[model samples]
Target: MKIVIAGGHGKIALRLTRQLAGRGDSVLGIVRNPRHVADVERAGGEAVVLDLEHAGVDEVAATLAGADVAVFSAGSGNAATAARRDRMDRAAVVLVMDAAEQAGVRRFLHVSSINVGCADDPGIGEGYAVYLQAKRAAEQHIFDRDKLDWTVLRPGVLADGDGDGTVELTAGNPIAPKRARFDQVAREDVAAVLVELIDRPGTAGRIYVVVGGDTPIEKAIDV
Candidate 1:
């Protein structure tokens, strides 16, 4: 399948790109930084430098045209202000949705944070609150798209260690423990779940929360 991944330079996106490309599927990663092009290519996927925050729907649609699936995995970095969060996390998703519909690409995979509900948490700080709010808004937009076959994956706090290939995947929000460890999942594990979702179109239109657990990757994705 031909696939396009937004935020191609992201850790999870890079992992997903390599997995898809390794299987001989055509993959193109859309990145804002020109320097990241070589990284995507080294991962065995083509790259297109386009900043989704400023790019118009037509321009994004042109890149998405003829693509079988589009994945939105971009995020504003740690130093992001509230305005940047809204633009990159919320509006950018809307732009991609419009472009995907216009390009006639029905299958879309979106990455969201498991803490999206924190938008309503009074204890959360302003910057983090806005980020969660933006993610929630983006999720609603994807859920509302009738023309798209969408799967939203909300992962808990991401970690850097290699994946154990086991996860606890459940519908809606799973019970997150007080300790962050229960929620700490490896990036590669999240990427592995995405690969399964990409191959299983029958599992579309559902939202899943993934974290480290005892279930095997393949079995956890039996949605």
Candidate 2:
């Protein structure tokens, strides 16, 4: 399998790249900074420096050609300005979807956040509110599309260290509520889920919420 990851330098993206490449699958990471190219290569994946925020659809499509899957993990983090959130979190997702269609890539794996459900809540901070709104918009765009076999994975607050390979995965609307204690998930676990989803084409058109739990990842992902 040939996998292309946007935001190739991200922690989760790097982890995903390593797992895929380590198993002999071709992996390519698209990053904005030229300096991150070495990091991607070090993770056992090829690197393509392209800033999706400014790159045209055709430019991105060219990079995704012949790829089996396109994973969108790009984000502006927690401290991004509203503009950055709209550009990267929202518009960049749309750009990748368009590029995937143009390049004939049918599978799209989106790394979203569980916080997107808070988009309509007024209690959150303005910055976080904007971030959730952007995520919500991007998700809606994917749900409305028909060309790509898309799967959105919304993980809870991220934690450090590798997880124990256990997770609670729920699909469709009214997603499972976050656990009070094990709400945070390890980045490596999220990557593991992505790896499993990559081979499950039947999981397309599904929205999943995953967090640390008792069920093993392989069993929890049964849908």
Candidate 3:
């Protein structure tokens, strides 16, 4: 499989890239910073520098051409501002949706948040509220597309740890836990699910909520 990942420098994206490329798949990582090129390449993927915030459709579409799948994993890094949220979270997804359609890359996997519209509890921070709103808008855009085969993944409170090859998954407008105590999940585990999703054709057009669980990763998500 040939895959393109936006925000290839991200923690989760790096893990996903390493897994995909390690398995002999051709992978291209979109990185905005030149400094991050080595990081992606070290993870066993080629890198392309393009700032999606300013790039035109044809420009972005050119990069996605000939790809089998596109993953939207980009975001404004730790900037608690509404502008950054809409620009990176919402506009980036919309841009790629257009580019994917133009490039004829139908299979898409979006890295959405577990906080997005989670019972509409108004989220925590000012930026988080904006981020969730952007995620909803972006996810809606993907869901509305007639030509796209897409899946949105909502993973809870990401942590850094080795993959356990296990996850708890729920589909379609899932309710977040009120206590939020059991939401912690490893980034590597999430990456495992992503690769699994890539190989699972039955997962198209579904939205999933993910977390750590006793079930094996392969069995966690019901097709």
Ranking by TM-score: 2, 1, 3
* Clashing residue pairs found in predicted model 3: none
For each candidate in the order shown, give its overall lDDT on alpha carbons.
0.89, 0.89, 0.86
Clashes of 1: 0
**What lDDT score goes with residue 141 in model 1?**
85
Whole-model lDDT, model 1: 0.89
Quick one: RMSD of model 2? Answer: 2.1
lDDT of 2: 0.89
- Worst window of 10 by summed lDDT in candidate 2: 173-182
Which stretches of model 2 miss by more than 4 angstroms?
174-182
* lDDT of each residue in 1-223, candidate 1, tens digit only: 9999999999999999988999999999999999999999999999999999899999999999999999999999889988899999999999998999999999999999888866767777677778888998998888789999999898988998789999999886322222222278899999999999998998789889898899999999775
Tens digit per residue, CA lDDT, model 3, 1-223: 8999999999999999999999999999999999999999999999999999999899889999999999998887776578877888999899998999999999999998887664245446565667777877888788788798898898888999896888898885533333323388899999999998889878998888888888899888777
lDDT tens per residue, model 2, 56-103: 999999999999999999898878889999999999999999999999
What TM-scores do the predictions have?
A: 0.95, 0.95, 0.94
Query: Number of clashing residue pairs in every model?
Result: 0, 0, 0
